[model samples]
Target: MHIISGHHHISMLSKDAKLNNHFYQQVLGLRRVKKTVNQDDPSMYHLFFGDMSGNAGTELTFFEMPNIGSTVRGSNAITQIGLLVPSYESLVYWKERFERLAVKHGEITTYAGRDALHFEDQEGLRMVLQNNNGEKVPDTWQAWTGSDVDPRHLILGMGTIEITVRHLNRLANTLTELFGYVEAYHSDNEAIYQSVDGQSFGEILIKQDLGPREKPGKGSIHHLAIRAKNEEELRYWEEAVKERGFYTSGIVDRFYFKSLYFRESNGILFEIATDGPGFTTDSSIDELGKDLSLPPFLEGRRSEIEKNLLPID
Candidate 1:
């Protein structure tokens, strides 16, 4: 079984939609590719922000669930997310640029067999820069050079997602059996299970700890997604997930991609998503984010949804 070819996406809960919008689109140079409400909960905005082309790996999405309580960081929830760069030179460029701009960053270090640097966003959302050699699914990321960036040379999927979990083995098995991942290697405190081909963009590492599970809230991970090459693969995944008796959701359209959600045995919320009907679904390259487009199911409530969200830009 293929454990999915690429890193489809990552979801985060944001307290301020507008602020998250500006930082990701204007500051980080990501394109506000789509605007819509959360499928599960229609009141909140589900925003997709990624590189110019909205490729699978480069996406950084947010759910404007501003009312969720503040987070108390711990294991069980994804602690920090990492974006893999092309090479060490790219990593160095980011480090220097963040420093020059006074972006708070931790000292650089080697991690999980790669060189890395860590930092947080304005809302204290943890993120990292990684330079690692691994197998990558084909992608298109238009670097935020403003004037132009050839999408062909864009970064691949997310480098890794660090989850501080109390349960290790169950999560490992879930990924392996259902998602096509295998035990690649391990650290003293964490086991690394990756797609057999070294699709290292998405990883589940456990920092063992004993405590109550983290409550989902602001600054917390909403979900981790795996890429299915197409709906046919995604259909196979839904069957595979249900066979394990997991709580899996029906396919939900997200304009750019389709998705199915389930809680893995390790208790982390995960998704299997298709890679088609991408960013150009509703609007042209120049018209993205100019309007909030929703699936047929949620378009009726757009006005009320607009009023509830605090203005960000």
Candidate 2:
């Protein structure tokens, strides 16, 4: 059985919460599904952007670190994030939209035989809009009607995340042996692995780079989270990771989903999160991301958390 379902979410660092929210919501046309604080560090904002419903595979989250420095790009890091759009035509729509909005982006190009548009957020967070023309997967992401972008051109979900590491064999072995990811494609220095039936959203592209370790700050990808079907599956992974002699964070309840965190041998953090008890656990769909939502453990300090967070409007 495939333990890792797909890309649950990719979390990054942002120096400015307001601009980050604006670029993602107004520019990229994603919905702010959740507004909360980082449980590990509640002073900083933990903002989540995804489809209207905030499905498991659609999330692109950020932790607002106002004083963080710029990211010094190098190896041993998640190099880029991939967002899936409906078709190749959607790339044209986004290209024109980015030009009009003055957002920096590259021309539509092919990556791994799929049409992709490379772009960067205001903070220089790297991302690619990949074409999901005929992938056989459930249509679970609900389109946000409020977005100015047409529903047909709306981003479907998260796609293959690009991770660059020095010791490719060690990381690749961990993924295939520990997580049950199968090698779908491979070149000399690059390899693609899929968790579920070679689905695009379930893929991870690994690039072997011998550069220095990345100095993470603003615009740096913090972690890549893969999906676990439920709490039971989450526990199984936690034990599985521990038994393999790797240190783990164990099963941590994030209120919405339980999570297990561990850094692979390459020093890249990976999170296994449950799919159940979603964002609606505290607020309804309509009310999602409108107000700050905290887990039960942090509810007592709501006032303090709210006061620290800068307004994102």
Best by lDDT: 2
TM-score for all models, in order of appearance: 0.89, 0.98
Model 2: per-residue lDDT, tens digit, 1-313? 5378788888999999999999989998899999999999999999999988789899999999999999999999999988888899999999999999999999999875589999999999999999999676546777666788987899888888999999888888998899889999888899989888668888889999998999999999999999999988888888899988899987888998989999999999999998879999999989999999999999999988888777888
Clashes of 2: 0
Instruction: Work out candidate 1's RMSD over C-alphas.
Output: 2.8
Off by over 4 Å in 2: none
Error of 1 at 25 (Å): 2.5
> Which residue pairs clash in candidate 2?
none
Per-residue C-alpha lDDT of model 1 across residues 38-123, encoded as one tens digit per residue: 87787788888776656776677899877677777776777788877767766666677677757778877887778888887767
Give the 10-residue window scoring lowest on summed lDDT in candidate 2. 136-145
lDDT of each: 0.73, 0.90
